[model samples]
Target: MSRATRRGGTGRSLRTTFSIARPHLRGHGLLIAGGMATLLVEVVLRVLEPWPIKVVVDAVSVSLGADSGATAGLPAATVPLLLACGVLLLGLVGLRAIAQYCSTIAFALVGSRVATALRARVFAHLQSLGLGYHSHAKAGDTVQRVIGDIGRLQEVAVTAGLPLVGNIVTLVVLSVVMLVLDPLLAVVVLLAAGAYLLLSRRGAPRITAAARSTRRSEGDLANTAAETLGAIRVVQAYGLEGQRAEAFDRGNARALSQGVKSRRLAAALERSTDVIVGLALAVVLVAGGWRVIDGAMTPGDLVIFTMYLKIALRPLKDLAKYTGRIARATASGERVAELLEERVDIADRPGTPPLGPVSGDIRFDAVTVDDGHGRRLFDELTLDIAAGETVCLLGPSGAGKSTLAGLLTRTSDPFSGAVRIDGVDVRDATVSSVRGSVTVVLQESVLFAASVRDNIRAGRPDASDADVERAARRALAHDFVTALPRGYDTVLGGRGDTLSGGQRQRIAIARALLRDAPIVVLDEATTGLDPAARAAVAASIAELTRGRTTLSVTHDATSVRDADRIVWLEDGRIVEDGTPRSLLADPGSRVAAWFRESLQEAS
Candidate 1:
């Protein structure tokens, strides 16, 4: 399996996601304050700009009227009022412009900070998860959650969150302005807003659902591509290129179809909102005109009311524009929440004392393990190896030899018994110390896309270059490694494709040697090597495992005969355990038959 990337969920609601994201933004106090201030200023400007229109209308009406009083006609008194209105309108517009600029900058800063912190936190949490959790999850799905999902949320929080507050405030301010100008027309606009809200409530759920499906399909597509690329060799070996491509195409088509559905709902919502706004304007115009003719309302009042009605619909329009982001954010937040809530299977025990260095002696007592599938892996299995003895386990392909090796290193804890190292139960010791004392080198050696020297040093990061070269020499990899164009510094592509399988395994052995652990486990170490290569690797293992407690699982007769003792496992049971000479001398022994078959298969 590839390393952990990130984990998140896909959800279908907006309010839940925003509430979940609140904690991430709680630290950005200055940004929140600035954005709120800008929103307030923008609303104030929306209300003030229309008063000037009212002023111009009143000034024109009075100037052309037949009235004679100072308050009724265009007298010298009207000049100061018109001039003050003009100046106030210009000043508010300038303030609104500055506030809008500040708001944008503040939101961008806050969004970046929040997204960075969340991604880092998620990455760190993933590191704490156990091997079992990682084994079942995909690297691609996790990567999307950490980078793409969180990034989509940043856009949502900035575009949807701040504007949500601003638009609602603008609507309220416009309502108050209209009510003060003419209450009857304000009632008409209010009714129209109620209708808009009702329609939004009716359609919002469907749009949100469609958006969530699209997001999930996109994530599935990402996982499919990642899995196919990682297993490109296997895919090509089986001639499955077309099959993988078809799977990806299916996922992509599903996402596109769902996205189209969401877009259609959003478009319909917008058209309906526009229709309501236009109808409200017509009603208000007719009512206000009648009141003006009856001398109950001024012509200035009618113009101001019309502007207020338009301003009130601004929130609904903002809602329309942000609908898609709100839906996507809801999905991303739910995904993140699900990942954060997962319990880590492997974690530190409470009040457990730290374990220091360990001796090489190993023992398994009543070591019964189940594969979690209601089948026994090993039943009542018990064994022991002295501090410096090398033991080889020989068995057929289905004999649970590899499973027994895994139990020794605590890669998995046995179900019903104890795995002890130097007389201490591995469960009683700290996880890192237990792992540090034992290392396993498997058949498929993993090499990162880094320089050969760095890949070797992964076993012991603090190892010097000289120590690394010495370890490589001991593993029989030094000569071949030096032959490369860049030698030790040569960068290897994924899984070290530039090198042969035997070379990769040798590097892995060198890495294990650098670790200098007292207990070493090798699983089918040279199973895939040629006869000459196997001889070289077997000799290297013998030299490196000197004076260490080594448990080697092999079907190779050469490795078996080289061991101090050979334990024959059959159906997860130890059928025979003795020195190699004694086991091989008995022709009827299962260990002898298994070794003969392995040698024949190699030939």
Candidate 2:
């Protein structure tokens, strides 16, 4: 592989991202105008600084050697002219200062807004992307691109982009004024500029590369931190805090080192520019002094030439600084674009119809699922559930019950064959439709940091307070919820840690009940509950499953006993299919043996 390709930075050309950002550039109109005004004011003030020298020189020359009446050649308004020039120069300088201040404010305001808008757009796009895209990516890395990297791009918009234009105009205008004074001196300044541009161009890519490396490492660091924090419980339990901390420190150190390298390159480029400018000034001074001694150029013209040279070189210094900032911004922008370009693996197909409403019937036809590892989760399994039927899935650990449940709700897609709800293939239905028609209550209930009522009502946003209370009561969660300090309005903290495991699970059941979907999959929903809570939850499940297609993956005999049909699975295949009564009665059956083992384990 090419070196760039090996670096994982070769897929998209940088220019394409810039092209996409062209529309956003329009946001800087006011900033650009303000910058132009500032440059013009600065050049006009610089151009006037040499006028006082000319006035003093002429005034001295006339007093020393001119004929007494040569006052006719000089304006009788000499004192007035000198005073007026001073006033004008002061006025120009003041205008320059004001314009400079306005430019800074304008550019900063517009640039920050543009950066924020761009980031929002990128984030919105990322959300639309497929799960397959996010699976191999890190959450922290994605957040870094959206937040940190996009923020860096603001410097380019404010400093490099606008100022580059403003400086170029200033340089051209000043160079012309200098040429009108002394062409030879103007040539010297242009030569310095040429050298500076050449050096800056050669250095741009190296600096950009270093900046890109720094940004990428920072993203990796963010990913490490987020990953560690996300699984803090696991990390603590496994005594992995030191190992994770070391990993994060290493990532942070790498980023810091790369940042140092980028800064060093930028500093070198600036120093080179300063050296070249200093050399050019020396050359101009020597040449101008010779011309003055030879009487070829007046001292006033020499003074003007020097002023123009200084003004011309000032922008070059500005450009050097802006160049480095631009490189960093480009690097940041490219990283953000990389994330925004990702596509989601699972999404509603184009032209797919809404599921509208579904009956409880479910069909799995020769369905097979691959776990993205080479292992098959299930192989060509076929099953049918009549409307409002309650079924139990009995499986050994790693027997693919959770995978099957995920497939039912379109959390994933089958590798071959299909899963249908009410005879409609899930893939052919809109995601909203499928999700609305089928809901799953996971083994571990997730509760947001909200009031108890809000948590239960989230499953159906339109649900009223009365409806939420009804659902909670049916789930057997109302009594405890009402006992909380604030009852239904009580806020749950830290994923509802204030409640016991059984309480959280009961709240989840309330949420599922509120959803009112035609099909429900309860996967180990009662696993962590105590005996009393487990029995109460099972009763609620029985009540809720009265008129829905229910698929329960469980080890609880009470839950299994309530199933109309029991499907026993082993090694990703259905090993037995029969009514629960028959399966439990068969002594030789794996389902019966597993049931007995679970009962023994529970006891």
Candidate 3:
């Protein structure tokens, strides 16, 4: 299928555009209505704008006429008549400017509000999509849709929709007035407009396709830049700057080519409109001038007819110019719509009760989980941990340790069977409630660019300063945080890059500690730390696990030694389960042998 076909084509795209924009527009109905009202006033002023010029032309003609008797019957002299017309011209111009200003401001306000609301909604929807979707999705592409595409919708509202509507309205009103003034001239104008419309319609599909391509190219370019920049450290370490630059250049070139094609098409359409309009004006001038020479029309009447025709057809000229903008916006809207339409696979079932405070008893009942391919990571796996139990999950990589933790957090559901906390099926409880009962620190600690205190308080937004300090102390991060230039208020760099590896881990621990969830998970929290840092983090881990039901996934024998029970897995089945001391004392045990090997490797 063609790219356009895959994206539902231009017609469907326009429909999707309206569907996404309708709610935002409706939300600010009062603002939209006020904008339209101003537009109406502006159109009215535009229609009346030509009358003062017509008056000036008539007065000038009479003043220079051979018949001085024409002024004898007039209420005022020709000089005063000319002066009055000039003043009226100024008034009309001033009033029209004011009306246009109001209309533009009103429409801009509505457009900005719509953009802000849609951006927020898109961001929230992305967050709600859960880990599974995000894991497989590109962060750069998602960011492009949320930020870039939504931004285009704002431009369409103000730069395309408002102007298009206002121009169409002005054309309609002026067309009526043209018919009243001269039927023959009006027909000429209508025929020219119809021809322009037909020509524009013929080119619409091409323009739409080119615009879609351009938008897609821009998204690819953005994705390329985001990915390369995000992996800059890796790129520099591997000396892959040249390769990355070449990739970005290719994407940039494609975007530029597409953009040029779209603009070229738009320019062609605009030039065609100008030629057609010029022809129509020439026909009007020739026909009206002949009538004037034949004594069938006045000069002032001819002037009015031509002025009105130009005013009526002005929007058609603008319409041709804005066609590409509208098509580009349609393309962007389709991308945004696709994101908003994504199904939230992980969400609370209807009427599911909130999981209250738990005693932290966790169980996996006859659980079977697949790796999303053909491999079954867990088959009828059943395990139980008592309240406040510190269980260490010991296994080689790919033995489904992290998957098990994912199941507990409801990050991914089991293929068949149930995961429960305190005897309540996780699926039967609200996702928020389940998450509220568990706190996890991943192998790689993730931190945002924020003040140290705010980062900790993210675990519990209601945490007071003292509460934050208490959690930091428990995680052994309080002393260092206070030693910083701004103490707890010191802002960290992106991903907390300003802090040491061990410091970041401790801050993460503090965050989890602040949550004070009954169940805690440490996924190899001490894997990469040096001896001293590891010792410090291990101490913090001890403090964090003191009263909580802790599940630690680790290869560190030190961590395993402190566990109340050790569960060993091989090929997704539990090979052994026992107290660490009992298991280590058994020389023939596979778990003991694995631990011994891990310790020797460390040495």
TM-score of each: 0.88, 0.85, 0.94
Checking candidate 3 for backbone clashes, the offending pairs are none
**lDDT by residue (tens digit), candidate 2, 1-603:** 222223323124246446446667685786767756766776566566667766555565555553243222543326777687678667767877776677777767877777777877888778766555667778998898888877777766666776676677778888888888788878998899999879976887788788888888998999999999878889999999999999999998999999999999999998888898899899989998788767666555566677778778878887777766777777776776666555556687779999866887888999998777899878899989898888888877888887787778776789999998888899999878888887778778899999999999998999999999999999888999999999999999867878888888889889989999989999888887889878787777776677899998887776788789999878778889999889889999988898888788878
* Tens-digit lDDT string for candidate 3 (204-267): 7788888878878888888888888878889999999999999989998999999899888988
User: What digit string (tens of lDDT, one per residue) describes model 1 on residues 1-603?
Assistant: 111112122233554565556678887997778877887877787677787767777777777772433225443327777788889889878988888778877887888888888888878778777656687777787888888888988987777877777778888878887787678778987898899889887877677777767777788889999999999999999999999999999999998999899888888888888888888888888887887777777777777777777778877877876776676677676666556666676556887665666778889888997775678878989999999888998777777788788876566778888988988888888777888888788888889999999999998999999999999999999999999999999999998887888889889889989999999998988888888888788778877788889999876677777788999887868989999999889899987777787678768
The Cα local distance difference test for each model comes to: 0.80, 0.79, 0.86
Q: Which candidate number has the best TM-score? A: 3
After superposition, candidate 2 runs with Cα above 4 Å error: 1-20, 23-79, 97-109, 176-181, 234-239, 294-300, 482-491, 536-544, 555-558, 570-572
**Model 2 residue 111 lDDT score:** 73
Lowest summed-lDDT stretch of 10 residues in model 2? 2-11
Model 2 residue pairs with clashes: 129-344, 130-343, 130-344, 130-345, 131-345
Candidate no. 3 TM-score: 0.94
**Which regions of candidate 1 deviate over 4 angstroms?**
1-12, 15-23, 64-90, 408-410
Of 1 and 2, the candidate ahead on TM-score is 1
Looking at candidate 1, the ten consecutive residues that score lowest on lDDT are 1-10
Residue 76, candidate 1: Cα error in Å is: 7.5
Steric clash count of candidate 2: 5
